[model samples]
Target chain A: MRRPQFSALRERLLRAGVAPRAVRRTIAELEDHFDDVRRELEAGGLDPKDARSQAYARMGSEEAIVASTLARPELMSWARRWPAVAFALLPAPAFAASFVGSIAVIACLGHLAHSWLGVGLGRSPGLQLFSRCFALWILWALPTAAAAVCTYAAWRRRISLLWPAVGIVLVGVLGSLTNFGVQWGTATSRTAISAGIGISTGHLLPPLVRAASTVGLALLIYAGCWLASRRAEEAGSEG
Target chain B: MGDAKALLMSGVPELLILRLLAEREMYGYELARAVRAVTREAISLGEGVLYPALHSLELSGLLRARRRQVGGRTRVYYNVTAKGRRRLEYLTSHWRRIATAVEAALAGPQHA
Candidate 1:
């Protein structure tokens, strides 16, 4: 396959952790510089091929350009670096906390409602399982909704898709891990796995189901949100 | 240039850029050519140094950039800020100090 022109230069700058905006600007400037040189050369009567080669020679080696550019860290300003990293990281904790907190609060409210109706959860295990599963779905759906809104806003602004996508995935991973931890803790304690009052592993399955379903639902929501936002952006741009 | 001269050149570009932009807004190509002309070819900052230096100066709030079409071509023009003027003042004085010291050293009695 034909290689992308300037791929090496792009990779070098990006690998050195240059801001994407700066790299893009640099690329645009390089193109202009080349054009200017080529124009000058062409005016002197050289053909396009010779003019192009001579233009490229005037810019010096790619290595030298990348080195000098990156040598001054301000060219990749911390203003750009920290904000992008922070924005990508912000949603992870928010999503995880929302998922876990939503589940916990919903579970508590469900328990209270059952107790008030004179039918405690443990007395009706099937109802308890259903309520918990519903709670898990809500836990997954709420953050997914919030993420969708964020994705849509970012899409409208033409911000990069990579960071938000990364944030959503990270949020999902973190939420899943927290959900697993809660499930394991609740199962171990409620099952009386210690104090010589062990219960069957089969009985500890509800929380496991809750954990898996919540993560699965979250991933689905994220994927759906990303797709919808991307479609909307494309349609808006085309229109 | 020797290592000593290279070291001095390191900080000189930013000064020259800020000084020139303080006078009037100019684009990358114009600035490069102007720098060469004004320095009588004693200093030649290639695109490599010119652009990154511009970006750095802009990031530092010493310069601001805008895009405008000139002769049917879009060009990014840079202008010095109030802060840039202050920076130029400081750098100019600093350069004068060093140049004066270097000049005195060169004119000192021959050790031989």
Candidate 2:
């Protein structure tokens, strides 16, 4: 029995996504098989080429064989984890945390608005608190949505600036509507409006502050995630 | 000829390579040529597919490789080993049983 050649096989295994260590182990096993075939061929008075072909015929389809070898749970797990862990450790976790935190902040702002408007935080008239709360929630959603879309696009190696631009535009429109709504409410109400609270200047300032801060933070997180994604991509390529 | 060659080559390509090396050690390109020649050129194995299969078999402990200088080019020659022979025996025996079963089934009378 003659031994089968393996150097070329190792290269193939690498391209097939087999771990390097596994490739080495598989090579060792194959070497043993080759030795057995060599002995058999020699005993039968067959030339090396004839025996080698006979042995190879028994080994089965290369595609099926490689597929089975790579299908082992541990190897499959390793392959799956490579991309997932690489992406997770990048800006993904940080972005997720920031998004959740922004939602929490928006909830708190809703509470503050309820308290200040003397709407009793929950007993405000005609969906007033609800509308404002919903608006605040949307405000929070704008940047978070942008961040998500951008991060996903970046992960997939696509252009992602659309998210941030759309987010900025949404915020601008929502902010103006909020301001107008507040002004209309104050003007039509009998309640004594706080001079500096919902007045035109005050109304303008709050949304500006919220928009500026949210946009700034969103951009910062986005930039970080983008850089991280790029680094991971480079690392994957190098590997 | 194409169907016959395809059928012969379909399931046990590694065995074919091992059998080739069992006759004589050969490099990757030579092995591919041998397969083509034996099958009367009905089945052409691409390097992309052949190399990967070779690498896999090597990993499976069915083959061994050595570097040799051949006509001024460095060629990696492949050969089979002891364990590979045992596996080949097992696979061949298993295939024989499968072939018998398939033949019986095919030759059996069919109900309308």
Clashes of each: 0, 66
Candidate 2, after superposition: displacement of residue B72 in Å? Answer: 1.8
**lDDT of all predictions, in order shown?**
0.65, 0.55
* Top-lDDT candidate index: 1
How much DockQ does model 2 earn? 0.04
Q: Lowest summed lDDT over 10 consecutive residues: which window, candidate 2 chain A?
A: A190-199
| Candidate 1 clashes between residue pairs 3 or more apart in a chain or in different chains | none
Candidate 2 lDDT at B77 equals 80
**Per-residue C-alpha lDDT of model 2 across residues A30-124, encoded as one tens digit per residue:** 55445455556668898888887765554444554465556443432243245333333333344445445654554555545655664443345
Alpha-carbon shift of residue A74 in model 2 (angstroms) = 10
DockQ of each: 0.47, 0.04
**What are the per-residue Cα lDDT tens digits for candidate 1 across A124-217?**
6665565557545644555455456445434433345666666655554443333321221121123111111123456555434434554455
CAPRI quality level assigned to candidate 1 from its DockQ score: acceptable
For model 1 the interface RMSD, in Å, equals: 1.7
- Candidate 1 DockQ vs. native: 0.47
What TM-score does each of the candidates earn? 0.59, 0.35
State the TM-score, rounded to 2 decimals, of chain A in model 1. Answer: 0.43
